[model samples]
Target chain A: MELQQLDRYAKALIKEAGRKIRHSLTYELVIESKADANDLVTNMDKEIEQFFIEHIRKDYVGHAILGEEGFGDDLLSLNGYVWMLDPIDGTMNFIHQQRNFAISLGIFKDGIGVFGYIYDVMNDELYSAQKGHGAYLNDEPIPVLESTTISKAIIGMNASWVVPNRHIENEGLIRLVKDVRGIRSYGSAALELAYVSTGRIDAYMSMRLSPWDVAGGVVIAEEVGAVATNLKGQPLKFLGQDTFIVARKSLHDSLLANYITLK
Target chain B: MELQQLDRYAKALIKEAGRKIRHSLTYELVIESKADANDLVTNMDKEIEQFFIEHIRKDYVGHAILGEEGFGDDLLSLNGYVWMLDPIDGTMNFIHQQRNFAISLGIFKDGIGVFGYIYDVMNDELYSAQKGHGAYLNDEPIPVLESTTISKAIIGMNASWVVPNRHIENEGLIRLVKDVRGIRSYGSAALELAYVSTGRIDAYMSMRLSPWDVAGGVVIAEEVGAVATNLKGQPLKFLGQDTFIVARKSLHDSLLANYITLK
Candidate 1:
């Protein structure tokens, strides 16, 4: 199928999935923890992933699927038409606040992303981008990122990163927080990247994130002239969890060179 | 006038002021720095404060007004009917993202808070409370805050507080951030307090805020059984800038005793 047709199909499927997730809020969610107590997963997360997987399998037989809830294929490589999905990006937010969470998805052809979508279910905002076609927010075209200095930049990051952590040294991150215009934490990697795409925030960083957490956001942000990389200034491999940072080109370079120091 | 009647009047006036502020967004804002570069004041802030002052003077004679833009009254004491207004809380957010800012207002009679209103212009959400009448959000009654332990709490605070700052030592605050489930910074004191009142967040803290910034939020939060006090566990004087913290009773007491340490 053509990329445009695929984009249309993905958007429609995602909206339908959002409706299901919204309806589930009325019922009691079966919650579980993975890795740690703070890392949560709900029944809705699994249900949403299964919903997308079933639809994709029937509609497009050859495509591969990699999803967060263990309902999709376990692929060793991204060498075909593959879908990377995080059914619910911020599970803790969904469980606590019932908001600030999203459904993030990205489609790649042989390891190159072609289409991305991040749907903020509570707000009904759909951020989408098709490679070389430009990014959009609910039918409106998103403008490209403008240049900003580090001192004037508003950064989105988890507060834990500024404290002592294993992934990166806290001293440099603390200094960066003091130097920036301001800092915000929304507890969702995908939503923060969507904010970067819209210029609501200049940059977003995380000590660790999986492929599904950032795949959709990376595409949307890159469409608007933003750069995405691991803390070491290397491109994402999309194979596992890694440190993440996405920002406008100038600010991204400045952060890597002066502010970020990996442990 | 009856407290309920005064509440209705305040609501109507606040909505009208919100309309004017929203309209001004289309025009180029006349911005000025106050105290420092980060402290900003815009034409809309002044215009909105003046708008409220004019209406209050005509409608409620002998009532004093304390507003952020300095267009209101200079009072020696809170002995009579008084209105505390912050025309635009989160001026930096307003100038940058054009959202997440709010118009905050509180009414007091003989030094006791009688009514409070916070109008989130962009989202059209109005959080209001009348003393002994309960709190509300857009006509829906807000429930009282539930108990949450420090380990399960999600806090709203500026990032600066965790770093080296004059108001509080960083060690205890850093430990608090690690112990909490999550942290968020919205950059708007009124909106953050509204979130706490609605139980969207467990607590909100600030290093320094003026009376106008916390007056409206304090009343609304207190209506829902949340405690509002300075960092040292004293009642807010509403006279000048001071450290602020608001939360459910248990969390508030625990935070003051265990987590907070002043410089």
Candidate 2:
């Protein structure tokens, strides 16, 4: 497989998809309730996802698609070529803030990520990577992260971990929160994972995230020796939302070894 | 009482301060331990705050200054004209991410917020407002929010609220997390408030934030009939951190009346 060509084509397609989403932003778009009325999935999300499916079917007819808007096919295995899509990862931020949203796409063959791209639509930043090659942010090659202790690390975590959530215990999360240098909670998991890949924060954690949410990010993050794994310290399950942590390898081990109560 | 002049000067100063910060990002700078090594107070932060304090003192002498990094005056009461400043509101984001940081300043008199400014340093977008005048995103005037109902609103919240924090009860916050249309946590209070003022998110809820963090944001947010108060719907203290909510007036009232447990 020509990873360069795959990365280039994927990048273009992601940008075009982003443009389509941007066009819909000012069309007095009708937003509909999903999961619940307060939980939104805009017409734009469907439009963008369908757009990707249309193009991929025409070009990569052999591929399977997994998407956030449910516009793609069902798949039992990642045995063939598969493309995971989150047309607008931060849909809420997109609908409300019109910024901080992204177009995330990942290509895998036989369950291994071959090429991944995450485009920050508003700011025009493209973070892309191919297996074994270094990741690039807006065309500049991003280096692997240097080591830092947990005490000196800036940790990215949503406050939900500290509350009475169904996922992790609150006291454990609170202790981690106090032990870290500081904490940040950006609403988008994909972007936060990308941030971790680039060494912005030493770690990124969430109680729930889908495969599409972390697929592209995990591909890029792994190139920098960042561990994108579940709480059990094993590889991610590309099917459902699970408790996940993507961090510099050392930090990830230390966090799992010291904190993180699994009950 | 000349807002344009103050905004003009403030804009320029903010830009200059941001430039100094951007310049620092290019160097092989040392990350020394302040309160904590990872809890950084960079040279850039100190320099930027000093730059603003110097100019404000030279020009707006009668203006009492309250700032982060302790570079300003010792304040007993906020009775006279007060300029609350945070050279870089998301200092952790700056020290670690080099983005998501901003220069936030709010001007108040006799405890009434009069003007507010939040400049996204890397993005170069300045959100500003003067009392009685409509808020503006850069040069475009922002209108008051028109959305109603908790279900239709896009809310900004740190998910940690669901885990376990002391400011607001976990059960109450979890219910809130489920009630909002969506949630976001950008790690920067100033930008999030700017988004709230401009109607990006219908409301914003956080456990504790400093006066400088919300001072500028609340002033701009109120111009559009958005309310800024503690979760209990009480006035905000201009000294320390508190559980705060800033939202469209209707949404704010609904959340406070229907949800949000203070004890």
Best by DockQ: 1
Superposed by TM-score, candidate 1 places the C-alpha of residue A245 at a distance from the truth, in angstroms, of 0.5
Over the true interface, candidate 1 deviates by an RMSD, in Å, of: 1.2
Candidate 1 lDDT, B1-263, residue by residue in tens:
67667788899999999888776664433342223322333667888899899999999999999999999888879999989999999987887777789999999888888889899998899999988889999989998887889999999987788888888998898999889999998889999999899887899999999989989988999999999999999999998789999998879999999889998
Best by lDDT: 1
Encode model 2's per-residue lDDT on B91-193: one tens digit a residue: 7778677888889989989898888888888888888889998788889888777757888777777655655566666676667766667666677889889
Compared with the true structure, what per-residue lDDT tens digits does model 2 show for residues A53-109?
998899777889999989898888888889999998987677667777788888888
DockQ of each: 0.63, 0.50
The parts of candidate 2 lying over 4 Å away from their true place are A26-41, A167-171, A237-243, A261-263, B27-41, B152-170, B237-243, B257-263
**Candidate 1 clash pair list:** none
- Kept native contacts, as fractions per model, are 0.56, 0.61
Chain A only: list TM-scores of all candidates. 0.94, 0.92
Off by over 4 Å in 1: A26-41, B26-41
List iRMS (one decimal) for every candidate: 1.2, 2.9
Q: Which ten residues in a row have the lowest lDDT in candidate 1 chain B?
A: B32-41
